[model samples]
Target chain A: MDLALLARLNEERAARRAAVLVTDLQSNTQRLVLEKDIMADPLSALLSDALRMGKSGVVESDGHKVFLTVQAPVLRIIAIGAVHISQALVPMAKQLGHDVIIVDPREAFASPERFPDVPVHAEWPDVALPRLGADRYTAYLLLTHDPKIDDPALHFALKSDAFYIGALGSRKTHGKRVERLQTIGFDEHAIKRIHAPIGLNIGAISPAEIALSILGEITAKLRLKPDGTKIGN
Target chain B: MLATDDDLLRQAEEWRREGRGVALATVVETWGSAPRPVGSHLVIDAEGTFMGSVSGGCVEGAVVTEALDVIESGAPKLLEFGVADETAWQVGLSCGGRISVYVEKVT
Candidate 1:
């Protein structure tokens, strides 16, 4: 409740950066742990574990107990096309508490009738994506097969901190897409972030099934550790 | 809007700023039929003013009772409510679950 702590917490929230506040039970002392500063914190192990898992809890450490509350921004998904896959994906993402926005310049596909109660931007990805402020917490999906729609957004997304970037295409199509991105000066490292052939290899034939796998993949990436150094479940 | 962790923290902080002694009880761990997930918080003030819920209509009165003492004595309490425990029936967690809550005085 100190003015300094309150202001710092507000600043982090406003900037959409993640933070955690830990209150020591016995001493009644408290400290704020920003995601960026986690490595340097004394409770770095506990703090980073909580942040990575996106859950907070109390712990007994060195005979002292403290409660840590993580304050991460809501995960966001920016789908670049209002196509059939998006119709299934948007509602699923919303149900999982992700903020979803569909961006497509084509009005016919981006109509309210197709995506009822969902936020649709009938604007090009180049225009809509900038306004969305896609950050590290945001995931991007390029659904349109059109180079004009998906490629421009790729240029924006690859340069930014979007956590996940996926494009819908077959393996051969993705190879060609990779070639195009390479010609545009995208390196192998940057382009590798895109999960082309879009969803997980769950043999999904229907749009809804594909949507399920894509969300499953996203959640796996979001929740699980690649090196399997997962902390608290 | 659904109350988030930050929202409850802010409410507890604001209450402390307003010269009210506040106790924060957070569900630290749970097992079996624990309705509330870990990290869920309930903020209680000196007069028993509160925001958020640590349990879904179960065992909150006991938590609030302990919170009042936390506010008075400036000490924190680690409380465990469970169907296996003696106070579970009195606490009303009849769903056969164990929940560990940590209550602390937040100055």
Candidate 2:
């Protein structure tokens, strides 16, 4: 690979942009294809497929073999509360290779000492989220259970392309939350995207168990198709 | 913190920018129950120093040795290892898997 190409690949990744490094196995030649430029390339079909599946593999392009090294943006977990669940979530999420950021307006809850090793923003979601900028790869965890904090974050997450938006609450609490969102102009279809009563149907009582269930659900959302079938199976 | 493949690539670039001879080995293909997935990387410098793994440490020694050759020759080589190989007892995967690694010099 060319040094310039390697540098560009790293640059694209740092900027959280999806890209693919295409290498011709026979000629030893390579090219870096940014996500935006894939459609214009000759190997657009193969490149798009590989990018969609978020996997790298060798594909047959016009009878010759080419290896596609797909570099998807790193997945991020933006927890809206620095509560115990979020504290438990930090290490587990990191182990699953997801970058985690904790946000809570409560200074005591958002202290770095409580959530050591992860970024803890002691500011409201509205103030911190914009600076953080949630993208398609971000998973929003509305664990505050405080509508004042979680509602604003939900507004931003609903408007964005965040893949997962889970809010911590009971069925009764979610009913009230849904009513508030409706009055605030969110339609039923949009409101349905928020995974209230968040996490899988596991009998979780402790914060750590709840965190595991939430991560499990997030993993399912990430690796499974909408119909619950595995992606690229 | 676990060093991701992204970190490995960034470290490889940094090593190359420092005027060191660098070779990158990627698991381009895997068969059976491979230890590491395809696209996994093991970056080897000319001094036989490496930072990542293409086979979960099963065949990294052989890969680093081949990567050193690629660094010196500036030619990419595709290497395969499996239980079927004659060197299986030495450097093959213990999981009874086969993997094809593509080793190339980073110029």
Point to the candidate with the largest DockQ. Answer: 2
Write out the backbone clash pairs for model 1. none
Report DockQ per prediction, comma-separated: 0.42, 0.89
Candidate RMSDs in order: 3.6, 2.0
Model 2 segments more than 4 A misplaced: B87-91
Model 1 stretches astray by more than 4 angstroms: A1-11, A59-63, A111-118, A227-233, B1-23, B31-34, B44-52, B68-76, B83-97, B105-107
Task: Mark the 10 consecutive residues where model 2 chain A has the least summed lDDT.
Answer: A58-67
Chain B TM-score list for all models: 0.92, 0.94
Query: What DockQ does model 1 achieve?
Result: 0.42
What's the fnat for candidate 2, on a 0 to 1 scale?
0.93
Model 1 misses residue B103 by how many Å? 2.6
Instruction: Identify the leading candidate in terms of lDDT.
Output: 2
